[model samples]
Target: MLPRSWVAGARRPGPTPPAARRSRLYAHLFLWVMQSWLAMFYIGAGYAKLTQKHDLLALMMTWPAQVDTELLRVIGGIETALALFIVAPLMSWSLFRSVMLVGAAGLLADAGGMVVFHTLNGDIFLAAVNCVLLLMSLIILLGRWEWRDHAQLRNATS
Candidate 1:
């Protein structure tokens, strides 16, 4: 509280400009909205895969009938885990930031797999949905990537 030397070098931050503030707000809103949507989607889909009888699941989506039951359940587990971690209250920790990227990447992979599977099975609607999920995953990954830090690291290394 009484460190004059430290205080002398520190500059106070001025009020944020309106454009900057609005952009920041929009970014936060986008993240929250996307996270909520993805979490809900994954949770519902995962829960259905985990708990529903194969016949019942197949009635809703034909892909489940073609996929092995064990494999389907494994995919459901992965989806549920990714959903949970994507919205986990760990963003404040720097280490958890990387986890978000991993979760996003996992979602991207899952969606890509689904897209291919659905497309091959002639499930156009489901394939389109998976395509949307893939886009969302890409957006989340881009939004979370630390461009400045990595760029600075590369420059420093060079």
Candidate 2:
């Protein structure tokens, strides 16, 4: 296994020369890809909710007693807004960060509800997928914020 020192040292900031900018660009491209994927997921989810299909309505019915159908629709609308914010160039970093944090929280709550639903219904696969998706969204949100902060710091120092 790799030494702990190596792992810790890997987190340290390094000199970013000219070529490093290209690497950063590539990293942003990768982030954009993930963002796009997340956006697509939200778009699909919003569409599903808007349609009020039988299956989706039934699934929403299974939501905890504390959460009402109107709340669920609002949540879906918020998700759709978040998905747009993440991909829209016109959105400021602060706005993006705010939306991302809110989105992450919503996703976590949604995942929790999914877990409860699946547990009650004995559908482990869907629960697992929801958990994984929630985790991934959290990771991406944090990573994007860190990347944005790092860039800001580098700009200030340079």
**Model 2, span 46-93: residue lDDT tens:** 666555754557656554334566766776776677667656643676
lDDT of all the models against the reference?
0.85, 0.68
- Give the alpha carbon lDDT tens digit for every residue of 31-98 in model 1: 76887798889989998889888889989877788888998899889999898777774556465777
TM-scores, in order shown? 0.86, 0.60
Per-candidate clashes come to 0, 0
For model 1, the run of ten residues with the poorest summed lDDT = 88-97
Question: Which portions of model 1 miss their true places by more than 4 Å?
Answer: 1-16, 90-95
Lowest-sum lDDT 10-residue window in model 2: 59-68
Give the best candidate by TM-score. Answer: 1
Question: What TM-score does candidate 1 get on C-alpha atoms?
Answer: 0.86
